[model samples]
Target: MLDAGADYLLAAKANQPGLMGEIERFFADAPANLTSTVTEVDKGHGRVEERRVTVSTQIDWLSGDRRFPGEYRFPSIATIVKVQAQVYEKSRQSSQVRFYISSRSMTALQFAEAIRGHWAIENSLHWVLDVTFNEDAARSRTGHGPANMAVVRHFAINMVRSHNDKRSIKLRRNKAGRNPQYMAEIIRA
Candidate 1:
């Protein structure tokens, strides 16, 4: 994205096997690198989650290193980040780990916040579409019907959410479909 004058902080996965292996090795040797750590705990939805984020900017070897095969050299990479997520439910616990490479120099806490902010928008939109609109059950995949219906669903959701009523979005949507006056009020709002 440097050609587009945009900075990126992207997660690394096995799709790029060499790069992912190198990053994993780097994290395995995090003690030698200049690394920082941050942690956050959240409790909700009958579960408790603990997230630990670690970041390092000591990857000077990548400046001209040809460790990765083919065109896998990412010169703009400035930091390596590792996130460990632990979850507890009904007295049982599990954990997972993920890694990322970033062009922007940010603290572990800032990186964690940025990641969480991105997921918040994604989760909120998915929740609204699935729970409030039953979008997952839609079978309008013929031609442009699915895309068209998605746009209409988004518009309806926005209209319902913009009203001043304290009722849920699903309730408001039901009222709008049943009552013409309420639908008119929602449209005007």
Candidate 2:
């Protein structure tokens, strides 16, 4: 996909033979010794997560990856990514050497936080869109209609998220929309 117009945060899995081989080659012949630290985390209700930090001291794993003449300059990078995945019937946590290739520098904490933040939104808003808002099951087939409605929904969601309250954004929006006084506070805030 990187070769295509879209940019990529490429992930390397052990199942991929060629890419895995390349990664192993880099790890084995890495200029500076590399070490990986793995962490396993468990949360209640069929939720398990594993995080890993692969700190390469000298070798630039991205060196062999395609780059414009002088686009990338870093010799090495400190990479960390957290995976909170579940396999049904039971839950277990294990860390594996799954690789992620991104055109950004990230710290270990950053990776774990990013992964967690991603799920927070997914569980909250995206699920709401699918279940509550039915964004996915929308039947709008008109030109620009879906896009327009999507924009309006996002605007509403953002406005609600900007408010301060124990109530959820959706609930806050509902209450504020029902009351002029509450609406005024939203505008002022």
Deviating ranges (above 4 Å) for candidate 1: 1-7, 14-19, 44-46, 59-76, 140-152
* Cα lDDT tens digits for candidate 1, 1-189: 878877787888878777778878878876844899999999999999999999999878655645434647665888888999999999799998888888888999999998889789989998999998899999998999999999999998998999999999999999989999999999999
Residue 144 in candidate 1 has what lDDT? 97
Question: Which is the leading candidate under TM-score?
Answer: 1
* Ten residues in sequence with the least summed lDDT for candidate 2: 73-82
Candidate-wise lDDT, in order: 0.88, 0.56
Instruction: Give the TM-score of each candidate.
Output: 0.72, 0.51
Which parts of model 2 are misplaced by more than 4 Å?
A: 1-32, 52-61, 64-98, 103-110, 140-149, 163-167, 172-189
Identify the leading candidate in terms of lDDT: 1
For each predicted model, how many residue pairs clash, with residues at least 3 apart or on different chains? 0, 0
